[model samples]
Target: MLNPLSLVSPPALRAALRDRLTFRAKLTAAFTALFFCAGAALLIFVTVLARQGTMEQFARITMDHTGGPTAPQPTSSTSLAPVSPPGPDRAASTPGPGPAASTEPWQKAEDARLARVEVNNRLQETAVRQMVVWSAVGLAVMAVLSGAMGWWLAGRALRPVRKVILAARRMSEENLHERLQLTGPQDELRELGDTYDTMLDRLERSFTSQRRFVANASHELRTPLAAQRTSIEVGLADPLPAHLIPVREDLLITNREAEHLIAALLLLARSDRGLDETEDTDLAELTRQAADELSSLAAERTVVTTVHTTPLSVNGDPVLLKHLASNLVRNAIQYNHPQGTVTVRIDDARRLTVTNTGPRIDPTRVDSLFEPFRRLDRDRTAVHGHGLGLSIVRSIATAHGGTVTAAPVPAGGLRIEVRLPTTR
Candidate 1:
């Protein structure tokens, strides 16, 4: 058989013990239980005190009727007049009062005591019954109020959490710039909202950059493809020797441009995926090798090349490091004036500085030089470049956990620097 206590146990209490109760449910249950218990305890105290007071009042009333706290004066047992003793014959004739009459003298006192006790018992019972009714009413009302208050308080506490949930539900990549902008004290919830807002800010910038990059890439590719197609169409128009030679040359040039564009795109993509391998590498050696590899390109441009090196070891992907150095050197040579000097230096602090003599660069446009496909109007000609050299250098340097900075030299050139973390 189930215990009566088990039958009376609250379902919410059982759920809470099983860890299946909601926070609001637990809070309401706790409030009800607390109010009920307090009411029950108070009722019990009042009932006991009232019963005791009623009994005491009844005692005083009973005592007043029968004399004070001292015992009542003993009823006189002596008879007022003397009477002659009955003979044996008379005694036999008059039956002695049996047990009923032998204790008749104290009958009044016994009746009074019984009467007081009955009244006290009735009064105490009535008082306890009234207490029960009042207590039940009060506890029911208290439970209702406590539940309402508990729910309100719990909702207030969880408001921020609900806001966060709603904000997250509404979020998407396209709408990453939106922010919660929560306004309140700097509590944990507020801090969480701020952190989420900051993350969205970064995501918005990255997505924007990616979109712009893709659009520019498509435009760049289309330009060369359109040229190649036009060249082919014109060459096929007559199928003559004169048209064929020029067409072949135009096609080859366009194909070379397309190839270079594709290679640059692939390298950029690979760099975005980060380094594939890392090892101890000397920046000085990489710089020297890059300068040598570009010697012919430099010579063709009538640009003088000089290399200064200091052995600086760093941990990075060698191929990417080589690409970074080569790109920087190539950019210096390609953008320089004819007969200009290109200086490649690897300092003791693991910095690679490439300085070249070129046309004066606008200081405002220095930062944009690292952006892919971004070139000055003058450098957009066929013989100049695809405007990806500086961009590739920046990407490769970033992949190696390094930074690149550039500034226009006062004498009319660009001085670029790449700083890498040295291996201990």
Candidate 2:
């Protein structure tokens, strides 16, 4: 058995109808039904009244023809005496079967019947007209009420969407912290709100990091610029006869610092944008060439270098890749111990590892080693360039969709691994 409550309720039916019909259409249908019913009832009432009137008129005419004095009368034959004519006074006093006499009772009865019928009919007609008018009026009132309700319901249903629109309109770059206060169960709108919030969070973090990087860059450049200015001012203001050589050397050092700063800045900017162009290049051949170029630098530090050759090919800017390999080998030789062995290994998988005997770095700071201006304590004395070698390496690797990692070896050295996607 179905529950009575499962039946379509009044509100449900009304809503379904409202969805299907427009306001004007519902009003038109209602008014048309009322008018048709009223017209039909009026027609029936008029027909009944006309029929009764015609019957009454027929009865009146029959009585008038039958009750005339010229009509024949029935006679009795048993009487012997002749009938005397009616005297004027007696005839005047007696009632004959004329129109007035024959029809008196019937006319009275018919008049009464007609009067009663007219009264009842008038009452009935009045009631029917009143009912139809009232019914139409009630329907009109209901239509007005329903219109008001529908408007209210439409407004309520769109309230949440309105709120979302307002929230979205208020968002901007400066006010990215603002978010929609959506209070509902999981839905498309809620999911949209969540995604929007997540995007804003990421953007905020990126902007914050960018701002910090700019500030740090400004500070780093200002130091070298100030030193250069001081050196120039001192050289111009006082040319001491005895300290002329030292002053020139100090100026040279300041100029070198400025040049280093500029180079580091350019490298960082290029890495951020990506390599200008890419071409097919042999990684192993490039590494061997860089090792040969850096052999003199390594020999001065007494670092014994060994290079393993393999045909490791990749698609990239050859110039940048050469610079990347040189930086890695140079850092290794510059930071290694006296007479330490520096090994460069290249495999068929385009994996290159550079290991050098050097003071081990703290594991916690290994990740930060690739950051610009970061340098290990052992390389502090090695000068003439900014601490951006590993930073450039990481950047080039990223541009080529590769990665680099540094770890302390068990044999008391640093092992740097460079992994590149092999061109198959």
Candidate that would win on lDDT: 1
Candidate 2 residue-wise lDDT, 1-424, digit = tens: 9986579898998898789985445655555556556655665676567556655664565456445323234446425535568788766765567657766766666666566556656665676577656756765666566556655664555456666678677654345677666778788767777777787788767866774685467567867777777767675565556657677767767776776666666665565556567888998999999999999999998999999979888888787788788989998887778989899999766688999997767777777778888876655446456778888898878777788999977766788999977641
Report the backbone clash tally of model 1: 0
Per-residue lDDT tens digits of candidate 1, residues 2-89? 8876765598666657697676667777777887788788878887887788778877887777554343343355254345587877
State the lDDT at 264 in candidate 1.
72
lDDT of prediction 1: 0.78
lDDT, candidates in the order shown? 0.78, 0.73
Please, what is the TM-score per model?
A: 0.48, 0.47
TM-score of 2: 0.47
